[model samples]
Target: MTMPQTITVLALDVDGVLTDGKLYIADNGNVMKTFHAHDGLGISLWQKCGFHIVLISGRNENSVTVRANELGIEHVFQNSKNKIADLQSCIQAIGCTTEQVCFVGDDLGDLSIMNHVGYSIAVQNAATEVKTASDWVTSLPGGEGAVREAIEYLMKANGTWDSSVASMMQEHANQ
Candidate 1:
């Protein structure tokens, strides 16, 4: 099987990737999203592996900040109209090249930037054209561990999967 390019940084779009593309808006303006635990663990593993992770989204959701904070993701750009700009900014901030970046997204809004990234992945549930544009299409649907699957592929492709996961497991087991 062919391997994905080296992924030093991963940039993702939040809504469809992390939350099944559904918004839970309460009468009082509260937002709720169901995130898979495995996905969270995968992100933690990616961080442990020393890969930079960022959330670059077009829309702003209340729960995103909470979730990102929970995952210790420091590079988050919400309400970005031009994703490429945010992506460029993120690349600069992280001191990486476009070839070191992997972009995972699920909609039309993500097309331009995804096209430019080194590796572009689409969730199984993404729009047809978006899927067509991706270099890889994940087996998991949006919000159903797609991000984790991508992370695992990337981590393994970059040769950091095993040790990172072991370290994360050990750390958790110690608590």
Candidate 2:
């Protein structure tokens, strides 16, 4: 089997991929979701290394806004019904091909985009149908370390994981 090209852009689905697939509403109709700090730092490092990242979601929530801001994520699309079309536009905006893109998703909404990307990754807790369609399965689940795993895999495939992570680790240790 042939390996996919080094990923230049990462497209992610919000609910399942970033927030463990739970949809909850508080008594006041507010939302709550937990985000992993490690995932944030990993994403920062990945961006510093020149990989572009985009987040796509069918729903909008407060947690997504906060997390995206914290991570310095560039492209974010929410309440999108036609996910595949939005993803195609994103790919074009990045000036990249399907061969240079990696998509991480955990539900059926993400399948079409996954099919078009070079690296299709699913978190361990993803739906069974999603798992079957993915090119790789992560050990971590969403809202845990799945995003981090995806970024690390992309860095590794691009031959920059070690040096980039080493620098980040060193900086953290010194601080």
Model number with the top lDDT: 1
Residue 168 Cα positional deviation in candidate 2, in Å, after optimal superposition: 1.5
In candidate 2, stretches whose alpha carbon ends up further than 4 angstroms from where it belongs are 1-5, 173-175
Q: Which stretches of candidate 1 lie over 4 Å from their true place?
A: 1-3, 172-175
Candidate 2 local lDDT, 50-122, one digit each (tens)? 8888899998886787778888887888898888788788889889887787889998878888887788999
TM-score, every prediction = 0.92, 0.92
Global lDDT scores for all candidate models: 0.86, 0.84
In the range 1-175, model 1's lDDT, one tens digit per residue, is 1237477888998889977988888999877778877788888888876788989877787678888899999999999988888889888978998888888999998899888888899999999999999989999998999999999888778788888877778988999
Q: What is model 2's C-alpha RMSD?
A: 1.7
